[model samples]
Target chain A: MRHTKIFVGVGLLLLLAATAWGSDTDGVTQETSFWIGGHLIDTSDYYKKVGEYRSFEEDVWPEFGLTYKSTTPNSRFFFKGHYFDRDEMFGMISTKVSDIFTGKFRYNSFQRQTGQDLLENIEAREWLPSVPKGGGKILTHDITDPDADYNYNRKEILSEFSALLSRENNLRLTVAHRAIIKEGTEQLISNSHCFSCHLESKSAKVEDRTHDFQAGLDTKAGNLDVGYKFGYRHYESTTPTPMAYYEDAKHPVKGTSGAEFGSRLNYDGSSMPIDAKPKIEKTSHKARIKGAAGKGQFASSFALSKATNKLTDLSAKSWAGVFNYAVPISPKTRLVAKASATSITADDPYIDVNTFREGKPSAVDFDYIRYSVLDRTTADFTAQIFHRLNPKTTLSFLAGYNRVAREDYPVAGDGTTSSTIIGQAKVRYRQGMKLTTSFKYRFEKTSDPFVSGKGLFEVPGDALEPVHYGYDAATGDSLWGYFYYMREDLWYQAITTEPTDYHEVNLSSTFRPSAKTTLNLKVKGVIDKNGDLDSLDVKHSKLNGNLSFTFMPDLKWVLSGGVSYRMEKSRGPVAVALFDG
Target chain B: MFPFPAVRGDSTIGEIEHFGSLYTMADYETKAQNVYLSISGSPTAKLRLSSTLMYNKSTGEYDQVNMPDPSIEVSSTLVDQDFTFDDMHEYSNLDYSMIQVSLGLSYKLADGVTFTADGEYADLTDDAGYVYGIESGSLFMVRSGMKFDF
Candidate 1:
């Protein structure tokens, strides 16, 4: 309630300013803690994933905590607070003055619970029989509001500042700000098809907000060390925009053609407006540099960004460049390298589904103009090497390459490109602190990967040949070539689960056999394939494992334990489409 | 491909020609398991104790590999029919299991006061129920507190 009275009035004004600054400061230190709690929850079946992120509701709460420290001699202060209810809370503050300036502030609040997809398994049944009169009808749903309950409430705030401009070639200045808020109520589903395979669900209202700001500057200009940053972000969603009424096209049991069902609908006797939430803005710029080359150290960066979409005014722009290097090559070898490049451009919109069957004699004119699969470009490179060979061993090796290019997609005017190559190896061992171990292996290869331009069993077989599109003179009926070419020749091209070859493996171990026992273990594996999917050999696999332990047998007992396992499997190809339209 | 005449007079063949569908292979799976335990202690100098335990289990499924003969005569007057999805894979199966437990205690009366208590329990077992049905649940929580320091 009102954020629990502003967190109990800021925890009683920070406990009366830390008790009057610890009675006239002098290496001050303070602590304030107060708690009076009550919590009780008993659930039988509220199953929202077991109170999705808690608040199982059973109240009566009061908790407050504070800590402060200051050790004069050059000034420095820190503070912390925790007020546990009102959807959890936290606060922090920091300060330093004397060695030039520093500041910090933070706040957080949380709550999340969402689950209400009672779609009832989306039923469907159409017993063939040359479908066309509602053929065996089934599939129906309508839940205008079935005791909906979704939740959301998140808040965050952060602030930071830094200063110290100039002190013999070591200048600095930094600033930051952040804010986020979300309020909720959700659940919206709308469906309509061929006329009556209905389904409808409602209730939607959510407010969202986000803000971010950044500023930076750093110095040192002789051996390098340079920096620059500027960023801004904004997002909005003031709720209110949820409407649905559609459902009026015709023939669902002979309601009559209605312009042949409004010529493959793109809007129908409607109320429109459903699920709308857009308004975003972003801007960024970055530049960085770091020094010392020959013996090691090197860094570089460049970035630019722009994103906008205030209700579809549409915009997107991106740029990136990066490089890094580390060196040493004697007395135990070492080397590292990295490179990156990125580009993106977007802005292409024009759709007018308003002319399809406008005054039909079988009218046709489906306006179009859209192509932007987020126009992309990317490049990456990597190199790594490390060696120790003795003193508790160490070894490493890596190689990488990547490329992607897209301007349209799949085959929109023929635009596509992809490439990938990677290899890796690692090993580590230690016996000093009882034990330590590591092992890794990786490999990847790809070329022409990303697919999905009308996926799923690229249909053909002459799209099931059977031509003859001529009758229907007020019910002579026969008009068939499989409904005008079986959806443009039954999708015959792109499809992918994205992986042309892949392999990975990892192993880890850690053990501390003495001073208060400890142990850990890990394992991972993956396998992927897509051999150009013709008869669909697309495959996927994964496995994971973990084990943990810890024990402290003295100082009054302490123990721990853990175990984990995971498995995943996939195999593609599932095409079943033969619509009787 | 001949066999026409329709408009409700029925001589069959209005659509669906030969094999225009059915091409199975589908198989999707998921599995998960987890276990955890923790314990903390302090035997003297004002009491303290803690405990925790957790368990989880998961499953997901979908299957199909071969299925096609349901009637097929594609010729003399065509007859094709072939469709079966096992109730859409048992309405998209998923099995679940979960368990959690927690406990804590503290004591140190005077000098800056302290005395606290905590408890929690959770359980779930939704064995294959999709689309928010039969969610099986259990939960219990308790808390008591008294702490002061200045």
Candidate 2:
């Protein structure tokens, strides 16, 4: 609501009459379109809730969208909105007055229903069975909807404005507010290795609100570019905590306790006297400058910024500065270098605030507080040479060196400083406009005796293995297809990181013999070993094939399908869970 | 403390996902506060000082506006649900205050030499308990130096 008044004042204050529109006569053009569609899906009960969002695998849903756009030489306005069956909606509008200033607004919202909660309430006679899916009543009407619906909804609004000053200077301002409310279940896990331990959960709607604002200005003076930005953000998050439930399931507040104290499944659905929520405030200030030296041949840029976030008694601060310079040596060679430093300070990090627990000694603590003091600096220098050998063939080489924390102490983590040195070289050859290839190699080593985690150039090939061949092989077929092969041998050893040898190979090929048919197949085998002995950590192979055809391409109608199968074997710790007796 | 409502034997792993689906659609927040004071200045060249102060307080309850009316009295059962951890909840809120001060002093020891001293102090206090239950804190630092030219 405050943002609306601010934008309105900005618009009125900056509403300058257009010089070109006052005398020139131009016709306006507009375009408007609307589409409404619905789908009938054969519901699948297994699609309960997937990927942190309600699944749309079943039921009938309606969707509609409308758009309107007006265009002219100096002014334009655009609007669009889309509504879906799951109580999801999106809308945006923007207008430009005489091309000097522009204003835009956006709003988006969606609701997610925890179906199981509603089902339980209905079966237990706590709610009327007259409820429907896709965002509607859960009980007879709205009687038990508040609890049974167990719905989470979020709505956010954003407004932005921009203006041009002195042709080269520009100013931009943005303000936004978002709200997220959930009345279902929330998970709270202690910061411990016991992930499988009895998970802590609460059934309640914890509300959260966030407000953000930013303003920036950029301009060029003489041969120098200058810019600055300032931002402020605030967040209030209320996490649901375990509490009692009311005896009258229908009445949240005016009901007696259903379960006695210390009894299992005892909940009163009562409001907490004090909720441990995180209230955070953050502010940032930044400035940048870029100028040309050496008669406009050497370009230099610099930026400095500082940001601090305060949440309750904890406070974190970040400061950074960057410098970059580039210049051309001869017509075919160019050199670039960059230097940057970042530092972070925390008054109270995430550590146990209280060392004593009232009754539960083994009970892990979800509350923590700590302090951090860290600083890191990095520098990069690169030299590139590109020469046209003859008329059609060209060659290029790039050499660069990157250093991290080259100087100063690593004040965080184990109270030890670690430094990195990286050197790399790349060569690229291009022949005419048909063939191009490149090869690059890099080497990095840590200076500290104790360091862990992924190293500079180590390939983390766990997620996926990709390989391809037969490109430009010139086969008689419309498209050439080849099997993929990859062999990687790299192992790291350290006291802080996982030391493992990773080797993987895979093959994938796609064949499009005709315009109407397509086929793709891929298979991969992997062998990952860790520790001093090359013991197999994981050995798995997978095969996948997909086939599709344009049954009736001419009429834009087609049907196709595919199937995939895979298996894996591993020697890691046995998959375990916290089981109850 | 036994995981709150549920007893020791409840298999809470799977229920987390099932229950999370009921309400975790989005994240929302609302806040309003005033900056009490933030100033930095020096009355004279010999003495320099700076201090900043801020306060934040929640407006009111957002979701439950129509629950308690003059028509019917609020039942006593509602009051029994006030069970909560000591350091938990922000129902009443806080009148927090954070202040930091820094001072610098310099005096000439000789015609071409001078000694300078600098000190800084900060304090933060809030009303909330648990993780943010920071009652108050103060930090002080002092440094002295001498300059000479010949």
Point to the candidate with the largest TM-score: 2
lDDT of 2 by residue, A1-581 (tens): 35435644454343223322322347767777665544433322222222124323244556667788766777877878877555468888777766466767776777664432222122111111232221111222112233333456666666667666666454334333333333334322211011111212234465666667777777777777777777777776555443422322221212222222222222223432233566777778778788887632344434444334344466656676666667666665555655566655556456443322224322223463343434344555555555555454445555555444522232344344444444445455544443344444444444442343322222222112222211234753332111111111222322222223333444444555555555555444444334432221322222222222222243333333343343333332211111111
TM-score of each: 0.32, 0.48
Residue B90 C-alpha lDDT in model 2 = 38
True contacts kept of 2: 0.00
User: Which window of ten consecutive residues has the lowest lDDT sum in model 1 chain A?
Assistant: A15-24
> Residue A34 in candidate 1 has what lDDT?
63
Candidate 1: lDDT over CA atoms? 0.75
Best by lDDT: 1
What is the C-alpha lDDT profile of model 1 across A343-440, one tens digit per residue?
Answer: 99888788877564456343456676787887888999989899999999999999999998887885555778889999999999999989999999
> Tens digits of per-residue lDDT for model 1 on B40-65?
89887788989999999999887744
Q: DockQ of all candidates, in order?
A: 0.22, 0.01
